[model samples]
Target: MRMKDPIPQFTDIITKASKLNLAYLHLLESRVMGAEDCEEGERLDFAYALWNGPLLVAGGYKPANAQRLVDTEYPEKDIVVMFGRHFISNPDLVYRIKEGIELGAYHRETFYTSSAVGYVDYPFSPKYLASEFV
Candidate 1:
């Protein structure tokens, strides 16, 4: 089936899954700025129509926005909403989210360094960890 528009194609897939009662999640990477033109209500409406299961939105959710996302009410109250990418540099991302702590900024320069400069060098927040009994 050849189609010029991809929206119909996507809708077809979702419709098929719904008929089969298959559970699936949609991971959206459209940055916040890209979605800025649309109102929050519009965004939620499109998201609900696309996928009713877990929605993992990445690329632009900071701690502040993530909080709002989780608090927002949608058609599917049980739908799982999650944030990503903001935790790339934050090893203690879960802890920080729970405690409402600020996340460390990721350095793009070291992201592709040959050595372990940015990949595994990000230190965990001391506040989230207990002192070692050395």
Candidate 2:
């Protein structure tokens, strides 16, 4: 499959987008896509180099790595790490990450295979539920 457009064309698109004065750029990096992982060292160097404004980055992001990425990877620019797969299985993901609780595991096999089984069957952390009750 021919994935990449010519550099000149891509640059033009990016250039136009940069000039739009948009609030922020949402970059879906080719790193960890969906339930499948992409190539090992693929970085969005092109977009990063061009888009200097705030960036909302999306992909497979766990709690720790997400924090570390914002702190270490691009400290200069305003970045908000977006989570997808983790959030699906973990309804109380924010609290879990905050309290260092183990996250609910996501089953790849069951993904997109069931109505309630894969979607809403995952249980919330017992601790989280108890805290909510209290």
Candidate 3:
């Protein structure tokens, strides 16, 4: 999966898109790549430098790390962190993150099964339901 400067082609696409005044650029990164859980960190500094506008990054980001990226890493730029698989496992994702509650685990096996098996079958945290936000 390794290649020498794999970004040239993508950067060229971004260069063309940048001239069109796009709203924002989306980037996907994760410590977990597909079925393998990797400890390697994500490096999107090139994307940050390429796109001067808003950037929406989605991956396996916990609340603290996401906040740090926005508030500290690129303080001067507009960066938004998005959650995908986590949201499927944590319905009250926002509330749980805000209250520092433990997040739920997802059933990867049932994911994308063409049914609601894992999509809408997960349980919610009782604490989140009892909280004032509910």
Candidate 4:
């Protein structure tokens, strides 16, 4: 389908527990800044940005007045989850459920789209164990 504008069109926004808080905020901003500019068929899309690097890098989505929206506008629509980096290393996250394993911290130097700085180099805890034994 051909889109009228350069921006993408999305009916729903998905977010995880880590993303839940911030997703609402970004949505609020988009509604405030971009909604007015959007067309009738165009609804603002919002999602929580994610980062594996460092403890401070974690972010959650916070939909603005989501409950209010359901009360007023879209009671049937529900946002789905589209986890980013968190799912990569923790593929069995759904199965583990309550597994209390410690997650590896990501290195900030390789977070961008450049080379694989934080991509693969951020060793998992197992690697740390092997190194410690050596």
Best by lDDT: 3
Per-residue lDDT of 11-101 in model 4, one digit per residue for the tens? Answer: 2223233455443322322212232322123234332223111111112212223334434454444433232344444444333223344
TM-score to native of every candidate shown: 0.64, 0.78, 0.88, 0.28
Instruction: Please give the distance, in angstroms, between residue 108's alpha carbon in candidate 2 and its true position after superposition.
Output: 2.9
lDDT tens digits by residue: candidate 1, 1-134:
22355556667776676666555555453443432422231143444566655555544566676556567545343344454444668888878877777888776666556977776778777787763421
User: Comparing 1 and 4 by TM-score, which wins?
Assistant: 1
CA displacement after TM-score superposition, residue 38 of candidate 4 (Å): 29
Superior by TM-score: candidate 1 or candidate 2: 2
TM-score of 2: 0.78
User: How are the candidates ranked when ordered by TM-score, highest leading?
Assistant: 3, 2, 1, 4
After TM-score superposition, the amount by which residue 60's alpha carbon in candidate 1 deviates from its true location, in angstroms, is: 2.8
Displacement of the residue 112 alpha carbon in candidate 1, Å? 5.4
Error (Å) of candidate 4 at residue 115 is 1.1
Least well predicted 10-residue stretch by lDDT in candidate 3: 1-10
* Alpha carbon lDDT of each predicted model: 0.58, 0.75, 0.82, 0.35
Error of 4 at 110 (Å): 1.5
Candidate 1, residue 80: the lDDT equals: 47
Candidate 4 matches the true fold with a TM-score of: 0.28
